[model samples]
Target: MIRAFRNEDSEAVVALWLEASLQAHAFVGKGYWESKVEDMRTLYLPLSEIVVDADEATGEITGFAALVEDFLAALFVAPRHQGKGTGTRLLKLAQKMRGTLELSVYAENERAVEFYRKHGFKVVGQGVEEATGHLELTMRFGG
Candidate 1:
């Protein structure tokens, strides 16, 4: 089931973000993701429009997407629940909410880059992320 993110979902959401980040962004140091946990919990998540995918039977949050206007700030699924269409479902919901969407993904995270591309997002620009000195690709969908 897809639903709005409640305050109580903070812990689970951040945990999933951390785990997924660690797995998908292996090139980045683990400490970097760990250091951002508090910011994700208190700053980023709070400031974005977030939606969660919950288990229909247990109501456990399995995945989530966060948006700041037309920009997809974050999308993550629990490591255990990935590759099961949850990410696609969340992305479709985001598309329905905003006809145009933009986002940046680490260039080294080929799985993510391919996933976004398969979903109709095209790489429009590229740059080095100052914080991590990693190549980042800017992708756009719709207009």
Candidate 2:
């Protein structure tokens, strides 16, 4: 089941974000993702709109998606939940909340790029993420 993120979920959400980020952006050193833990917890999550997909029985958070207005800031699914449709469900929930959305994905992360494409987002531009110097594509959803 999907629902708003609760304060008690802080650790799980950050852990999921770190794990997924490291897995999906393996081109970058693991330390790169680890370094963001503090900011992810103190800065990002508190400032964004986040939703989580939880196991109704165990109440374990399996996936989560976040947005800052129309910008898709973050979306991550625990490794165990990958390929389980949890990611797609979270993305669709975000779409329902924001009719049009924009997001950036690492150009080297093909899986994520394709996932966004399959969901009606098209690459509108490309640039480097200053923090990591990784090439990224900016995509936006139409209708």
lDDT for predicted candidate 2 compared with the true structure: 0.94
Over the stretch 3-37, how does candidate 2's per-residue lDDT look in tens digits?
99999999999999998888999999999889999
Candidate 1: C-alpha RMSD after superposition: 0.6
Q: Count the backbone clashes (under 3 Å) in each candidate.
A: 0, 0
Alpha carbon deviation, residue 108, candidate 1 (Å) = 0.6
- Itemize residue pairs with steric clashes in candidate 2: none
Question: TM-score for each prediction?
Answer: 0.98, 0.98
Candidate 1 lDDT, 63-137, residue by residue in tens: 999999999999999989999999999999999999999999999999999999999999999999999999999
* Local error of candidate 1 at residue 102 (angstroms): 0.3
Error of 1 at 31 (Å): 0.4
Native-to-model Cα distance after best TM-score fit, residue 45 in candidate 1, in Å:
0.7
